[model samples]
Target: MFEIKDNHLAAGDLLAEALAKVPGIRHVKEVNDLSDIDKPTATPCLFYLYYGDQLTDAANAGANMQLKQTWLVVLAERKGSKQAGTNITATIRAIAGKMTGGAGPWQRVNTPIKPKYTNGHAFYPLAFTCQMRFKGALK
Candidate 1:
């Protein structure tokens, strides 16, 4: 059998699994638009995954092509209390450590720790750039 695997989607699945383990993260899902961001009903943290820098090539004897891409893990924490948002971001940092040096396949990059303020709310964002390699082909 033959198959075309999506490296970016695979990386995202791995990242989402890693984040679900963290207690402070309430909701996690792939995000395309920022205006409709909604917090998790069970928790205060909302996460969105965006993919960028996708590159692929098909230059081999077989019908398969090389694939690589980047994933952005954006975290938005609502500040219900004075220290609520702080606690959420701290958990995000720890998740980064696990993704970069732990058992995850993705490598973490340098991103700003500053929180963007809008509508009287605090939004913390973190992005992980993952370089993945795979062979993909369409039938």
Candidate 2:
């Protein structure tokens, strides 16, 4: 499939099962054991997610194009939760190499929707941002 589940929304059981399959265009997995923070009047909650990274640089960079592998960092956080919850993020280093002098060896990274807690599903009010630099661009 072109799109997969996000980390926050993935159920434990579903995550386990998906992991066993050969990743097609996308893959999803939830992570736990992360840090947590307690709210003033809310139950203490932990941060987690189902994450996947794919490389589409080959197609993006044609035979004449140069590929420069570089580390890329992705940060995801809840919009607002008393600002008490710890930010949960996943790092998929060197996802897409640089596109030489061109713009980039473009690619897309997707995170599953947060699960709902009531029906054993939880909502992850999260936002994501990315940072990347080409191989030789940095000093």
Candidate 3:
């Protein structure tokens, strides 16, 4: 059997690394809450969280497992500047481009959500999913 925690960490790390390379993204982290995000330091940042998982298939009397895991990535940028919208759009496309080729194990499951403007910030959420398959018994 495979360790789920390790897989989760690897997947999250992979995404974080990829997003970090995107232009205009200054910070990338796994966040528990959006309300507490610091706009100044983390603006033009990407925050991701593991949403949930589902078992899609199983075989070999439980020795093999196929699971689908989902993650949510939020892009936060400071609003007010005329280029804020343009920057957001560029970042979105860059992110989508990164996801288009497929990372180690993660895939962009759906289109990014519309940006929500509030409190001098614009937030765009993107969803990604991955399929994890574990076969054989643990050592």
Q: Which candidate number has the best lDDT? A: 3
How well is each residue in 10-128 modelled by candidate 2, as lDDT tens digits? Answer: 22333233222322213233343222221112222223232322233432234322232222121222334442233222222222222212323323333334333332222343322
Candidate 1 residue lDDT tens string, 67-116: 44455555554445465656556655655545532234354655534566
- Candidate 1: TM-score? 0.62
TM-score of each predicted structure versus truth: 0.62, 0.23, 0.70
* Candidate 3 regions with alpha-carbon error over 4 angstroms: 1-7, 38-40, 80-105, 111-115, 135-139
**How far is each candidate from the true structure, as Cα RMSD in Å?**
5.1, 14.9, 4.1
Each model's lDDT? 0.54, 0.28, 0.65
Which candidate tops TM-score?
3
Quick one: ranking by TM-score, best first? 3, 1, 2
* Candidate 3 clashes between residue pairs 3 or more apart in a chain or in different chains: 1-138
Q: In model 1, which regions exceed 4 Å deviation?
A: 1-8, 38-43, 54-68, 84-90, 97-103, 112-114, 137-139
Q: Sorted by lDDT, highest first, which candidate order results?
A: 3, 1, 2
Q: Model 2 scores what on Cα lDDT?
A: 0.28
